[model samples]
Target: MKLFQKLGRMPIGLTIPAFAILLVVFGIPIVLLFLASINAPAFSATNYLGFFAQTANVRVLFQTIEVSVVATSICLIVGYPTAYLIVAASKSVRITLIALVIIPYLTSGLARTYAWIVILGDRGVINNLLLQLGVIHSPLQLIYNTMAVYIGMVHIMLPVMILPLVSAMMGIDRSLTAAARSMGARPLTAFWRVFFPLSLPGVRAGSLLVFVFCLGFYITPAALGGLRDAMLSTFIAAQVKNSFDISRIATSAFILLAIAVAVLFLLGLDLASAQGRTATTAWKSWVVRISKLDMLKRYFSRFSDSYRAKLWTTQLYQAGDDSRLSNIVGTMFVLLVMVYLHSPGLIVIIMSFSSGTFLEFPPSSISLQWYQTFFGDPSWRGAAWTSIQIGVAVAILSTIVGTLAAYGLNRTHPRLRSFLTMTILTPVTIPVIVVAIASYYGLVNLGLIGSRTGIVLAQSTGATGIVVVIVSATLANFDRTLERAAKSMRAGPLQTFWRVTLPLIRPGVIGGAVFAFLHSFDEVVITNLVSGYSIRTLPLKMWENIRNQIDPTIAAVSSLLMLVPVLWLIILYLTWWRSRLRDHRSRPELET
Candidate 1:
């Protein structure tokens, strides 16, 4: 009774709800996948064996790896310098630069890929411009090739690459570079030797993220690449959605899962080693200096004083330092990138409002005729409604699961923590095509295929990992002691969590929910496989239209779809801005 009472005093918040949702949505679907994989009528490892039986399957697997690795490498090479530049910049400059990196990801990926088609296609902007310049009499075959795939994949994955690298770079000590410089190292040499080594973890993290994401990518390559350039995802989609081959699909799906697990394990090992070394050194030093209380106090005070001084100076400069030409140039460059990233999506939006029937770069006149045409059509309306329904369900379910998994992992001991984290992150690592095939096979055997519930379930499974990442990041800033304090105050675990933890991490939860919603909303490949005749998601409808007919209605639908994510981003930004304002007002100097 006492132990139960004690446990009851622990905080509970969204964790319980999260776990329940995970069990019903993510856990069940995964279980179904495994069961279907192994429980075929003539279960004799045939499905697994058949995966290896085809030379084409092996080639597709290798090709997927090759494209993912190459794209990830390119992202790293480009994103690293960008991240470094952002982290090294002044506060305003950093924010603006970070915004530039994130703006591309804010738009619909399909729309962006289509824009690339316009730019890289035979009669597209680049080729047309080149021909006009007499650089070449003939247009280059840039689109529907490996080069187009690489370019589109790199563009789509660049934000993911930049985020982790920026996070890692921000953790490095700025003084380390100064110290090296003082020791007679040139700026370039010091950066290469001292700074680069420190930033490698971020590089690895970013690279893994980009690679994993690229492996699952569908629309970009499908739109831009040739038949020979089809990656594993494209192949898997064809096998399951087009050919209806369950056994082969399972085998390929498992292979993707295996590869993801292996890569994540390797990355986990590196992160553990790096963190352990840092922790151990700090702990040892603390133990050795236990007796020197006065010295420690003095050292801390001096450090605090120095940091305070630097912070004050930085503020003054930020308030009045508009004359720095480098800062101006950096800001301009960031803005230009933002414009470049946003132009294609903006073009799509503009074209959606075109009075003309076909797409034009600069529409003669803007009208809402296309929007009216789309909303007035039953198929488009039904698809949009269905997408919304699935997106909402998936968002709520995945957010719950993610929040629970995040809390559990955060509060638990180190034992199996890495494994749990890796498991939750596996969806992101494995290609979406594999997930689609696996879920399709599972749902079909259960007579759930084409059902709305099944489509929602599949989307939720793939989206859970993203929710977990977002929720965990939110909890990273949370204070555990608040829960303990509530418990000490005789509050029940559930009460403490509801009153303290949930409110504190609400932003993270909401952010995760928003991301999950968008992910499920934009999802096309998986939904195409698992969804029956009854359930057609918006992206699937758009894809069908693209494949069967080229209409301005797609442009209209995509423009509206693009608005959903952008609106969510605006809301998030507003929330963040409001929080910052509150924080500033609370501070003594800022208040003045």
Candidate 2:
């Protein structure tokens, strides 16, 4: 009782358990790994020099950067236009499109990568179709190439780019664009001048997110690209597999981390500028730097206005003639993008039902043999059961720890809260490979390398961060006065929270638990490093089969994995809907 009262008095104490887990599982080990990288006590550049001396190492390093840049550019190019069209659609259509985008985003990355394999393998869908149609004499070298890497990467990353853009575009006042049109600006001109500039922050955010994620391109590039296309992550994994050289692996991991950090510093500093004073200073400095450009813009605007005045009436009358044609084209483009985004998963699901021994797009005979095979295989069943147990444990641990951390942070000073939040989110923000390497060291010290508990803790580090973010967003909108009113009525702190706070935040808690489970269930990179090759979780087993052989049973597994995101969406919708209903019913009571 005394300890509980003391902890309540010091709200920050509530965060102790979360921070303790993070420090033990991730923080200390990372610091030790950095020391080993430099040969601590006699800190030297020899390890780094040795890393860069190899020509193949240098080439792989540069190739990693090049591939990341190209992939990020492709996502931005495709995502920007797709986002604009989605935002321009009717409200119902916008909602549907957003949901479509998120479904893929939440689906397992491994499943998506496998979908590409089913579509692009030598004897896969495209070649088989071409041969059947007599369009080619032989299969084209498609699956293991740079082009396939780009396609697989863009397919996975497109949603990450689109969602941010859509959110940013939604916040812009439509009246500004309408007002621009009223002043004789053509739609194209108005959009370029008004909307594009406003969407830059979204572009920056999405590009940074994609580029950083690309630096950690393990599954896609390795699965889709040839030997020459390996990124730093694939290289690091190979190093770990071939030789458990801690120093070598740490050096490579830090090099990748350094690149990610440099990019974040360039593109995401503004994201962390929570202090108004710093933002104000940066804004003023940017305004001064662009002052000359403003003059050039003014001159260009004057010239454009004069040119538009001469042709405004003619262009305005001409616009009606093209409106229907433009709409048709826009609709077609959005549909094509949607097909590109979703067809892979659909193809995998359909192909899973084939009666053939291997995956084929159109089955000669549709049957449930593959699913039955999945059920009958003891290895598959055991892996899945292990994954379920680990996922449920991670969910329970992350949700409790994360919710408490969020509650404490909500009551902390704003500056401190921002810093702590960023610290907690580091596991998810950086490359998965880096987190894997660090967690490997952490688990080694604990002698938990081959244990399920280690995997759960490793996964929960990232899962906890996810829970914190979701629940914090929920807490931001909570009505604190209700808690205060409960307290004033002689309710104890625990009673006030149980009666007033928990019910309001239940939706966020449930959503956080779902996402945490998903994070743990879909995890492969970290689980691979820490699993010691003894424990076989579903994703690890699936990834093993993917690398070793083409198993028809995996198709059944992938199809089921594809349904996870849909289930997540349904669960989230129900929770939020129930919360909304309660809010609606209580509104009249408040008024009375």
Candidate 3:
């Protein structure tokens, strides 16, 4: 007890268990995998040199970087404006906008990638439309190319880019732009000078995250990309399958992990600064210096003062109707982007109801035949049940461990908290493909290979930090006075936590659970590595189906899988709305 108090009265009981769980499950596996890389039979760089010296390996590395950069650039170009519109909207509209972005974010990634198949296939929507318009006599090759890969990557990654941007944009004061305008700056000038510079931190941060994610991308690229389009992840997967050369596999896995970590360092994005304030300050200061440059001064000075004033007052230069129209267009563009993001899932939904064999653009007849096929197939049914069972177990385990870690971290000292937080988020920062490799080798040692338990264990490692972050945010806003009051009434630590703290942060717990389940259900990279034929999840099943089969049954499964996240989101929305309503209703009573 004295030792615990010396540690700044941290929740050691809660903290240690969570740490132990992650250490044993996540931390140890990565360490073992890393050791395997260096601790070979001869203990040399033979494996790594032999692997990387190949011309093919070097080309794939460059290709992966090129693809990642292109995808990240596209996400920033698209997400920045959408985030601006979201921040500028009314309260209700803002919530709706966020929901719109997050729905696709939470939906099953496999189902989502499958939706792309329906749209980008030769007889898919684009080809069918062009054929009908008499623009083409034959179907065009959309998928199995570089352009298709970029589109799929950007679509899946846009929400990730927007989320951080929203956070960064929300911090900037709108009055700053008005202040700039009042100082004789034009509307575009004010926005460019004031707004755009402040949002750079978000831009940089989002770009880093999106690029890292795209680097390790597998599912979408696998579905739509040809063999020539294969990235490092695809290369790694191929290597894993063809050879059980432990040192070689570990070397490849470690290389990917090192690259991911190096990215975070190069971007100066420490996990300790996940809140973005430090990153914002760093970039904001740098941009501020550039604004004072002679080049900018000379350019602005090019326009004479009187001419500038006259130009600003002209009909073409005035910013009333033009600004409103631009805003309207911008909002419409965002709406179109949302439609583009959701087009695949919507296409899948329609195709699921069709009475057809192919994933036809327009079904000759509309019926429930595909749905019936999904229900009747024993293989599909078993895969889905295994996914559900594994997902639930992952959710429960992650929540328990994450809640403890969050509560403990919140109560600990800043230095200790930062270190612990870094450890927790380490799993998230590393590429999933790397983690999958580690998992495969680690599970082999534990004799859990090809087991459902292995699947859950691997997924929980990736998901637990999400819960920690969410619950930690909740705790940040919690009223500590209530806990003190309970303590003053002679409540024990356990009693205070159970009766007071738990109730207050139940929403965060629920959010964490939902995310955990979603992560487990949609996860494929790790599942592909750890699972056997008998232990296939819904995503693994879909992955196999997409390789050769082009049937409505898979579309039906994709459509149904999309509904789970939607249902979870709807429940969260309703609960939040009801709470807001109740809070509003009670305000008048409190005033009286």
Identify the candidate with maximal TM-score. 2
lDDT of 3 by residue, 1-592 (tens): 4553444354745667667766766678778777778874557777678778999887888888899989998999899989998998898999888888988998887888888878888888889889999999999999999999998899899999999999888888899998987667977888887888777778877888898899889988888899889988988898888877777777877777777888888775642334455655667678767786767777788778778767656744445787788888988988898898887888889877777666676777888988888889998898889889999999999999899888889987888887888788777877788878877777877888799888888888878888998899999999999899998998877777888889778878888999888989999999898885558888888888888787668888988888887899887777667767876887899899
| Model 3 vs. true fold: TM | 0.92
> Local error of candidate 1 at 89, Å?
1.9
Determine which window of 10 residues in candidate 2 has minimal summed lDDT.
Answer: 269-278
List candidate 2 stretches off by more than 4 Å.
269-307, 313-319
**lDDT of each structure?**
0.74, 0.90, 0.83
* Higher-TM-score candidate of 1 and 2: 2
Candidate 1 lDDT (Cα, 0 to 1): 0.74
lDDT of 1 by residue, 256-367 (tens): 7778768877764355437734644655567667767867776887767766566655664354455476567766755555566677677777767779767665678988
Q: Name the 10 consecutive residues with the lowest summed lDDT in model 3.
A: 1-10
TM-scores of the models, in the order given: 0.81, 0.94, 0.92
Residue-wise lDDT of candidate 2 within 1-592, one digit each (tens)? Answer: 6775677678788888899889999999999999999999899989999999999999999999999999999999999999999999999999999999999999999999999999999898999999999999899899899999999999999999999889878877789999998789778989987787667777877998899889998999989999889899999999999999999999999999999999988666354323323544666568779798877888788867777787876676564757798889989989999999899999999999999877788888899998999999999999999999999999999999999999999999998998898899888878999999999999999999989999999999999999999999999999889888897899888887778898999999999999999999999999999999999999999998999998999999999999998988998998889889988999999999
lDDT of 2 at 169: 83
Winner on lDDT (1 vs 2)? 2
Name model 3 segments beyond 4 Å from true.
1-8, 39-43, 270-303, 306-319, 578-592
